[model samples]
Target chain A: MSNAISLRGLEKTYANGHQALRGIDLDIKHGEIFALLGPNGAGKSTLIGAVCGLVKATGGSIHIDGHELPRQYREARAKVGLVPQEMVNEGFESVLSSVRFSRGLFGKPPAPKLLEQILRDLSLWNKRDDATMTLSGGMRRRVMIAKALAHEPQVLFLDEPTAGVDVELRRDMWAMVRRLRDRGVTIVLTTHYLEEAEEMADRVGVISDGRLLLVENKTDLMARLGRRQLRLQLQQPLTQLPADLAGFPVELVDQGRELVLDVARDNQGIADFLRRLAANDIDFKDLHTSESSLEDIFVELLRKPA
Target chain B: MNFYSIHAIFRFEMARSVRTLMQSLAAPVLATALYFVVFGSAIGSRMAEIGSIPYGSFIVPGLTLLAVLTQSVSNAAFGIYMPRYSGAIYEILSAPLSPTEIVFGYVGAAVVKSMVLAAAILITARVFVPYEVAHPFWAFFILLLCAVSFSMLGFIVGLCVDGWDKLEVVPSLVITPLTFLGGSFYSLNMLPPTWQTISLFNPVVYLVDAFRWAFFDVTEFNPMVDVAFLLGFLLVCIVIVGQIFRTGYRLQH
Candidate 1:
């Protein structure tokens, strides 16, 4: 099947000469939750803006389900929805009216039931009559989601949907996103929260310095770059590492009270290292194995020289 | 050409106006009524008639123009500016609506508001001073032209300014002074030759003269010249607003 969204050499350089995006080429699959992982000022928002037609691309093109943007913009834009990072709503307008108005903007006939359902799904039905300004921050974020879904868009771009949200709302949002993907809607989200990407993304794309560093299947990316560590708490204070275990990737930490062993996920070196430690009579109070998270991989990726 | 989009924006903006009726509608009407009470009743009885029209009746078109011009700018400017200020403009920007449709919705609503205010001012003026329109069609023509043109100017102003204070500068300082000097209270004929020549450069003068002629069939400049100038100004505003949308000037960034 064709890609849900496609960009070829997409670029954006502000008039002030800030290159927000440079030569970004990406294709998002249908019904997949693609998480764009990037730090602040890494062109995540800029990429989304260009696709949604809010920011003009200085060069290259974007095609939304085979329709070119800004030319066939009406048709192209009809297929996509955006929930911006900023919490902006028509504050004085009721939640229902605001969402209904958004649906109307897409030239859709008023579907009261669909809007009601969306509001219900986002748990905003109770506040449908309330002015958006009266809503709590979390409720307002849900309202933003309802507005984005109002037009029944096939593809949704959520720019940091859970930023500053409480844990409950964040979990609720993640569940809602999973439900959206289950319904065959392609989801592209940009987030600073690595755990969000780790927990929700089907595919993960890392972007840094206006460049797309890598795009890979979530599990594959994790397994390829993820590291495992064995931390040993020494029973007694040790002055330094044992000479016999110098061949292993072990470092004494916590004022020589702990020994840390770094090993690859697929490496069998840990068993041999443990046998060698026993043979050398190294005593430890306890030991625990920890694996590197997506956060660790992301930080490591960004820390590398471009 | 998306009527649904245009209607959505128009209805939403109109609803906002209804919600703030006091500030959006009543305030302008009451202000115009006060102008009539002060300028028409207090001062009219002492002044001589100008061009066979009573002093009270003569200032009616000028006063109405003043209220409509100021309201047109303020209404349209605030309508667009509020969305930008609140960041709600993203919804409009990301929608399927074209630039022209967006402008149509905003400028269209602004025109409706200014027209309503103009009508209210005209009806209120009748309570304080007696007046009749010699050419009702031309009167409405000038009224609409002024409202739409000034609203477009207001749209441009809203796009250009970044803050609330800057929004007020054009309507308060520039438009108010221009309308006062545009002969809203007195005709250019009342001024000396040099001053009349200088007053000719004031664009509001043409609008006031056209509207006054529509009411009293009396004007210093040719009715055709006033109409031409009004259309010209309207066209210019359309071009500038069109360019703003086309280039996504402040709207995009």
Candidate 2:
């Protein structure tokens, strides 16, 4: 089957000459949770807007489910939905009507049952009759999600779904996302929280400076870039490093009282390195290991040349 | 061609109007009714007649056009502007809707509102000034045309501007003043020679002339010319509105 969304040579430059997207080419598989991680002004939102037809790309071809955009726009857009970073529910419209309105806006026939299910899934059924302006911030966000889901879109773009919410709300959002993916809906999201991406993303794409730097399976990205640090506490202080262990990535620290070995998380030479350390007469009273979190890898990736 | 989307947006706008009855409906309707009471009956009754028509009855068509024009422009602006101001317009722009369907929803709702206000004013005028319509169907048709035309202009106004303060500029500073000088309260021939020439430059003059011709079969300008002018104005509004959407002027990122 074809990918859920495909973009090629996508570019967006504002009239003032600020380029928001620079030649983005990507394909998002169906029914996968893809998280786009980027800092502010990293063009994440611009990319989402272009896919959803909210922003016009300066140059590119976009196909959503095999339908080209700005040409077969109606057909292409009908298959996608967007939950923006900002909530827009200040109208006196009730939650139920707003969701129903979104369904109709997508050219869908009125489906009360589906709307009910969406509202219920978002935990907004109880507030269906209340005016949206009267709801709390979290409830309002849920209403946005419900609106996006009301049309039964095949692909959903969530921009910062959990930017500043509490832990419970964040977990609830993750659960809702998983539920949607289980229903065979593709989920593409952008977020500032690396932990959220680590916890929820099946595949991750790191973007910066209007370009995608890397796209990889979450596990593979973690294993490849996540390093392990081995710290050894020496039995006695030494002023110099052991000459026999020169081949290993070992550095003396703590005033020569300890040796720190840096290696890839998937490295298989740790046991050999230990045997060599013993042969070299290096004595350690204790040792411990720590792994790099996603945050660290992300920072290091950004700090290096693009 | 998304009829469902059109219906959805239309119904949403109508529901909002009903929800804010006092601000959207009652206040404007009541103000239009007062014009008929204060100007059409209480004030015009003592004034001299023009062209053998009672002064009270003479002002009905002009005032009706005035009511629809101002109300349609303001209502259309407000209907679309609120969503933009509150940042709810993203859903609208992102939806699978064509420009015609979107305009149909927002402008259609505004036209309906202006018609309701026009109808209310008619009823209110009947309770005060006795009036007759030589071509009531034509009157309704002209009023409908006016509503749709000005409502389209209002739609453009809503999309072209950024702030709330700018939204009111068209209805208040432009439409209201134009309608007032467009022979709404006095006959075009009553103006001084130069002012009458200047009044001809105002577009609202033709709208009032056509509407009054529908009511009394009497027109200050040639009836055919006014009708042609009205159609031309409607075409201009439609073209400008279409351009606004096609270019995504202020509606897109």
Candidate 3:
């Protein structure tokens, strides 16, 4: 399948000489939930802005569904929607008029039913007649989303869509995103929340210092960089490492009350270590295994120089 | 050109004006009425007629021009500037709108507004001072030309300014002072020879003179020169506005 969006050597340099993006090359597959994970000032917003034609890339080109950007910009932009990070709305405009106006801006014929459905879906139908300024911050954000989706874009870019939202509202947004993905819409989201990426993304791309560090399947990335740890709660405390298990990568924890083992090399390594502990006559009442989360891998990746 | 997009933006801007009727429509009309009361009645009774036209009638064109110029610039400037200030400009910039369509929608609404105010002022002038247009068609042509040109200038100012202070500086300080000095109250011929020659350099003077010629058939420069100057200024504004969109200056990151 062709990519929904494609970028080659995309770069941006601000007038002050700050290089925001340094040659980013990426392809987002159709119908996939792609998450771009980055820290602050990591060029995530700039990358999205370049694709949406809100920022002119200093170098390189972008294509949206085979249409070149800023040239065939009308056609290209018509195929995409952007929910910017900024929570901005027409303060004096009614919710219904705001969304309808946005739909018309794309040169699309008015579809009142579709707009109505969108408002209802976002739980904004009841507030349709109210001015945007009268709504809560979360509600205004919903209005922004409704406006973006009013044109029914094939691809949508959500730049930190859940920023400053409450936990319940964030969950609702996540569910809404899942619904959109199920309907075969391509979604590219940037997030500071690692769990959000881990929970929703089919593929994850890590970027830092204006460079894409890696792009991989979410599970594959976790498995490759993640480490597993075993915690054994011993019935008896020990002060020092046993002389017999000198070759094993194990350390005492909780002031000798538990044996912490780094079991990353192989799955069966845990079984082998357990057998060695049995041979040494070590007693344990309980044990549990823990694996490193995507957050850990993300931090580790950012720590390394590109 | 996407007419639908243009209509959408135009309609949205017009709606805002309706919502802010007190500020957008009433304020200017009331101010123009005061000018007629103070400058047309109180001051006109003591001054002699200028160039075969009543002093009260002569200042009608000037006062109308004053209102239209200032209103056109402030209306168009504020129209575009509000979007930028509120961050709603992102929707416009990201939409499939060609820069021309965006400008047309915005400037078109602003022109409509200035013309409405100009018409109201003209009707109000009839109440305070008697006047008749010698070339009614030319009067309308000059009014429209001035409105379109000044609206374009306002559009440029909207794009160039980054703060509220910068936005107010041009219309309040520069344009207002120039219009007053452009013979909005007195004809340039009444000034000393050197001052009259110097006043000719003020672009607003050409606008006022052309408009006055349309109204009373009296002019300091050829009417065609005035028209050409207005068109020339409009073309320059168009070029600068087009460049702004091309470079994504202030609109894009």
Candidate 4:
């Protein structure tokens, strides 16, 4: 089947001569969780806005579920949903009315039962009659999500979904997102939290300076770029490393109390390295191995020259 | 042609107004009622009749049109402006909605609101003084034209201004003063020739005159000119509105 959402050579230059997006090309597949990671002013929001039809792209073509933008906009837009960063609500209007308004704006026939189910899913059914402004900040954000889902869109774009929520709520939201994915809705979210992408995304994309640095499978990316460390607590302190073990990539930490050896995860030869250390009469009281986290990989990727 | 979206926006706006009934519906009606009590009851009892019609009855068309114009501009302005202020505008902008549909949603609501206020004012005026509409069809037409025109003007205001003060500036500083100067309370015939010539420069003068003519059948200007003025004002606002949507003005960036 075709990609759920597609973009080719997307470019946007504001009237002030600021270029927000530079040649962005991406495809989001159905039923997959894709996370876009970028730093401030790196064009992540611009890319999302362009795809959602909020920002007019200067160049490029957007296709949503086989419908092209600016031409088949009605059909294309009908398939997409966006949960923006702002916690805006109709202060005087009830939560239910707000969601209904969103459903209507998307040209959907009113389905009261479906709307109620969405509110229930968001845990907003109890607050349906309350004015939106009376809710807490987290509750307001949930209301935003309900509005996005009101139309039952096929492709959902969530911009910083867990920006300001508490950890428990964040986990709940992640579970909710996974349920949506299981039901076959394509999910694309942009986030500053690497852990969010690490935990939620099936595929990871790193963007910097308005260009996508790389897009790869999450597990493959971590295994390929993630480095491992074998930290051994030495049995006895030594002044320096022995010439015999100089071939190994190692460093002394904890004032020479421990030896840390760098290891490539997929290409690790810990057995040979351990045998060599035994042959050299070097002994360690205890040792442990650790791999680089997604945060590490993110920092390493961004630290590289664009 | 997203009529559903337009209808959704209309319902949303109407609900918003209903939620604030005391402010939106009751306040304007009360404000207009004060005009009837003060001008029609208090002053008209002592003043001479203008053009063989009771001074109280003569002011009906002018005051009714005044309410429509101010309410149209204010309602349309606030309808779109509040969304921007609260950042809820993104939903509609991103929806598969054409610019025309968005305008129809917002401006349509504004016009409906103004017409309702006009009707409320006319009914309230009945309690203070009696009046007759000589050309009822013409009167409704003028009220509609006035509502649609000023509502568009309000839409433009919403799109063009950024700050709340700026939003209120057009309605309070400009439109209200223009209405007052446009003979909403007195006729241009009552003014000297120089002042009368100057009054013609005020667009509200034409609207008020046309509406008054519909009620009293007395006007200083030709009826066609009044119709042309309303149509021309509406055309200009529509063009400007089209330009704003085309360029995305403050709505996009």
CAPRI-style quality class for the chain A–B interface of candidate 4 = medium
| DockQ per candidate | 0.71, 0.77, 0.76, 0.77
Best by TM-score: 4
lDDT by residue for model 2 over B199-245, one digit each (tens)? 98999999999899998889888867887887888899999988887
**Winner on DockQ (2 vs 3):** 2
- Tell me, per candidate, how large a share of the native contacts it keeps: 0.79, 0.81, 0.79, 0.79
lDDT of 1 by residue, B117-150 (tens): 8898899999999999999999998899999999
Work out the TM-score per prediction: 0.94, 0.95, 0.95, 0.96
- The C-alpha stretches of model 4 lying farther than 4 A from their native spots are A243-247, A266-268, A275-281
* Share of the reference A-B contacts seen in candidate 3: 0.79
Over B148-202, each residue of candidate 3 has an lDDT whose tens digit, in order, gives 9899989989988999888877778988899999998898878999998899789
Q: Provide the lowest-lDDT 10-residue window in model 3 chain A.
A: A262-271
Q: C-alpha displacement of A117 in model 2, angstroms?
A: 1.5
Candidate 1 residue spans exceeding 4 A from truth: A234-284
Provide the TM-score of the second chain in candidate 4: 0.97
